[model samples]
Target: MEKVIILTGASRGIGRAAALMLAKENIVVMASRDINALIELKKEIGASGGKSEALPCDVAKENEVKKMIEDTIQKFGRIDVLINNAGFGIFKRADKFSLEEVENLFRVNLFGVFLCVKYTAPYMIEKKNGQIINISSVAGLNGFKGGSAYSATKFALNGYSESLREDLKEFGIAVSLVCPGGVNTGFGGAVADGKISRDFLLEPEDVARTIKYLVDESETANAKMIELKPRRRKEFR
Candidate 1:
């Protein structure tokens, strides 16, 4: 079947990698806030003989999120997958989080996932099949200090993805949560920390390949949640 996917956070990082990898076989709707970067990525995909279109949209806003899904449907006729990869984080002590920080983190990480799924789910249902992949984190599995806000969002995402998986199980729409450890995306609102080593970090392509593998599963198989970690610890030395 010809696949069409709406992938958020495609301006860079994991989203960008997934878009490039999946577009080789699927029609990709690249949605992100960085217009220039997305346009460039779209061109790169085109040059590679892959199909993709760039949409500059912020997942944090409901109106924009809705419009993004609508635009994808209008263009592609059906959305076969929704990859909720858009996210950010600010590391700090739990007590140090400002109200704005909490709201902002939730706005993009939790609420964004909800809104994207809300708007895109029905079309998947109508087709009687689809995939929703939520990019979570190991921090969500085990909380740590200075990760209060960031961990909360991913934890909530895991919870929601779990329930949504069962809710739509009968409808042929699969929801999957992927919790990866220590990706080298310069994510979490900071560049790769100097104290951190790449030995324990996953590359963006590794996670991208995971997303593709999950999306490619047959109807008889469902990988509900997957966790990817580096083969060796960075601090082993």
Candidate 2:
């Protein structure tokens, strides 16, 4: 059976790559705040003979998250996979971060994941089988100079995903976390201006492939968490 997958932040970066790859075999329901980009992605997927549906969703908002889940369930009858890849980073000194900045980061990076899972888990429980992949970062595992606010959210996400895995294990739902080191994308206010050396960064498709692997794994086994990093490390300023 073709799996029905819900991928957040499908407009760009890792989410976009995952959507494109997953749509080749599964029915991908793509959600992002950028409706224009989502529409364009939908068209591209269609042109490639892939199945996809694009929906405008700001995962930070509960109502929007709820509606996205409801819409997917109504259309597909069941969600086989939920990929929470919607997140951003504000890299700056810890003291430089304003309260609003911290709050906004948490809203999307941490709270947003919570809202999505809260609304989607019951359905998976009812079905007794599903997969939830939360996209995290290496900063979540180890702190950095300018990653205070950003790392906090991912750290929280790490803890949340661990507990969620335990909670859903009994019901046959697999909760996995993918933590990738600096990827070659426009994440964290970084511009993809082609100046940065690609050797030091992991490609979005690399993470996408890992996601596909997790999705294709046998039901009786769960990989739990997978961390990806570039082999070469170079300083890019």
Candidate 3:
């Protein structure tokens, strides 16, 4: 049977790249808030002789996430992989940013992943085999001056992924976290606009390829966490 993958944030950037790449092998179920972009991706995958289905969902909304998972199971029977690539970072010094903005960042970056896992894990446990890949960030490992809120969310994700790995290992459900340093996606653009250099950053396809590798490998090769950083770049203090 062909493996089924549910990829969040499939409307654009790394999520879109992962959906396209994974669809070449597994059945990709794309979920994101942008219905139009999902339609376009459905066409792209179909044209490339791959299986894909798009579902509109805002990952932060529990009801929407629940519905998306239900629809995916109905369409695909079972899901073998879940790529939680649905997150964004908003940079600002802690004092300079409002509390509401920080909450919004957390809602999407951290809480949404929690909701996805909450809704998807039962299905995976029933099958007794699956993979969960959470796309965190380098900021998650260590904080930067202007990344207070965003960094906090990612840090939460890191811990969450680790705890999940421990809890789900017995169920044959592997959990992994990708902590990339500088990907040339909307993140890079955000940092660039904030006056940080983004030269020679890793592209979205680079990260997507790593994700594809993780999902395609056998259960024995359980990769817990992986980090990717740009070459010859200054480290954030």
Summed backbone clashes in each candidate are 0, 0, 0
The local distance difference test score of each candidate is 0.88, 0.90, 0.88
The total number of steric clashes, by the backbone 3 Å criterion, in model 1 comes to 0
What TM-score should be assigned to candidate 2?
A: 0.95
Query: Residues 177-209, candidate 2, lDDT per residue (tens digit)?
Result: 999987988886432444445567888999999
Candidate RMSDs in Å, in order, are 1.8, 2.1, 1.5
User: What TM-score would each prediction reach against the true structure?
Assistant: 0.95, 0.95, 0.96
Ten consecutive residues with minimal summed lDDT in candidate 3?
Answer: 186-195
Give the lDDT of residue 32 in candidate 2.
84
Which pairs of residues collide in candidate 3?
none
Off by over 4 Å in 1: 234-237
In lDDT terms, which candidate is top? 2
Candidate 2: list runs displaced more than 4 Å. 190-199, 234-237
